[model samples]
Target: MAAAAAVAALQAWFWNERFWLPHNVTWADLSGEPGPPGSGIQYPRAGHVFSAFPLALGIFAVRLLFERFIAKPCAINLGIQDSGPHRAQPNAILEKVFTSITKSPGGKRLEGLSKQLDWDVRKIQRWFRHRRNQDKPTTLTKFCESMWRFTFYLSIFFYGIRFLWTAPWFWDTRQCWYNYPFQPLTSRLYYYYILELAFYWSLMFSQFTDIKRKAAKLANYAKYQRLCDAFFMLFGVVFIVTRLGIYPFWILNTTLFESWELIGPYPSWWLFNGLLITLQVLHIIWSYLIIRTAYKALMRGKVSKDDRSDVESSSEEEDVTSNSTKGVLSPSSNGSNRINGHVGSGQWTEEE
Candidate 1:
């Protein structure tokens, strides 16, 4: 494959004499035949990098399976329910019109739709309502998804810090560039890099699924919004610290500024740096979107509800009612009133 060939070429170029060959050592000395006692010479292997790609794929498969079979079931047991069975699907023309134009069809528009579809106005209304509700992910589903990501990010952040804490590069970033490609990739660093890359790849793969679930209408929008805001804030902060802060200050600075002596204008060095820079650029763009959402919330004096995701009718109210009924019973009148107030505020009223 082209990719495999490219990796092979880069590895060949990286190990050439111009990079990392000591003054006394010849290419023959790198044949691993016990050069000298305690010389600490390591003949670098490019296989480690290629092997990590398959390992990353394996981990991704495991995570996907775990989410579907274990996490989803556990979430359901914790009382996360989809709003109920949807009404029969609308015809393609009707669906296209409703989604593209206006979610909430008016009196005259409803009449026109009824005429066009040859269905009762009430049936058309129900179809649109169900269509909208179908887009909103259940509370339990969102909770589990958020918890999974939060746990992964939190663990990886700490793991990365621990792994790099005692490394020479951690203390003096310039050291990363000193030996350059001659420094053999350690197993710890190899796994760390591959796992992190895999996580990002998983995110990219599931992005469409996340978008579908991000419809922003839940049984308890206020409570859910609080969770969403907190998670987004945490994720944004961690991303900035790792991708924007430490990466540029440590990794990029060393490779771009300090590594020139060892790398000596190699195309591989430029390609590798280019990839890191591209990741930083993506992080900046996502950060901007996150900040814009927060800014809009601040300016509006409330979390901005995504009206695009709102359903038109109260058919889904039963799901909210069931959720309330499952709550703990209060003995005192004051306690009952407080609980009622909270539920009332959280639930979607007829007006909504």
Candidate 2:
């Protein structure tokens, strides 16, 4: 819950680009020669219908639905299974299935059924154990599993003319048909920004003292954390430079109005330009925050109290010296000279 809240707060602060959608279609320069970027119309053309929808939806779906709701729940459950409760959460479900199997009269332990039933039960138990050990549910794993299960039927359904689906003319121009969406320059920039925000929240969640005990091995997270931060930093730079630097060229080289190749002409194109600027600016900010957070997280463990070894050693040395000085300064009870010379050398012949 804390992790979810942290992510929600970050989304509000850094990645709140929802306001840009309706505004993205607003006219920036109403008087300019009109035509959409490639077509000469005020609205999206049939060929470019897919481009009308932004890529932000895919990011949202992945983050909110798949990751937060599905994967996160499973991960948290598995993480809690190490020692919590007598039965790991999944075990309870597994036991129920086993009981159902055992209760079925058709699955009776007759001559040959005994061996087969034992093997089947063992397989089921093994699967449950494996699932219990995976503390985090990966999106890729779930996607791959779904893909594997569906691929055979999908292949059968589109056996002969599957190549038609691959054609750009028939497929959506936005590159978001069956595969994961939001791969374009505009969409991907924001996607990275979202990931940056997510990583920031993840690092914050890891900071909880109680959770820290569970995640002491930072090496597991350090690799991906650094990679994500580095990618966001680079993407942010590119976004800012591309949007600001190329806006003039995209504006000046407008032949779509003359060619009648665009629907929304300059007005629609300007909207895209404005949106690009806004998104890139936000991306820059998001990346900056992510970098800051990641750097802090990376240094957190290093700055911990474990570095007291040097101080402890020095204190111990000082204590020994102080004790020696006190012993030397103390007067002998019988007025006898104490250590008149160096103890090791033993060279003194008379007491001072």
Q: Report the number of the highest-lDDT candidate.
A: 1
Per-candidate TM vs. native? 0.58, 0.23
Which segments of model 2 are wrong by more than 4 Å?
A: 1-45, 48-265, 294-352
The global C-alpha lDDT for each of the candidates, from Candidate 1 onward, is 0.61, 0.38
Q: Which parts of model 1 have CA positions greater than 4 angstroms off?
A: 1-44, 53-57, 68-70, 73-78, 89-113, 120-143, 197-227, 234-244, 301-352
Candidate 1 global Cα RMSD: 10.9
Give residue 142's error in model 2 in angstroms: 7.9
Tens digit of lDDT per residue, candidate 2, span 239-278?
Answer: 4465555533343233223212322334344565566557
Positional deviation of 72 in candidate 1, in angstroms? 3.4
Q: Which ten residues in a row have the lowest lDDT in candidate 1?
A: 213-222
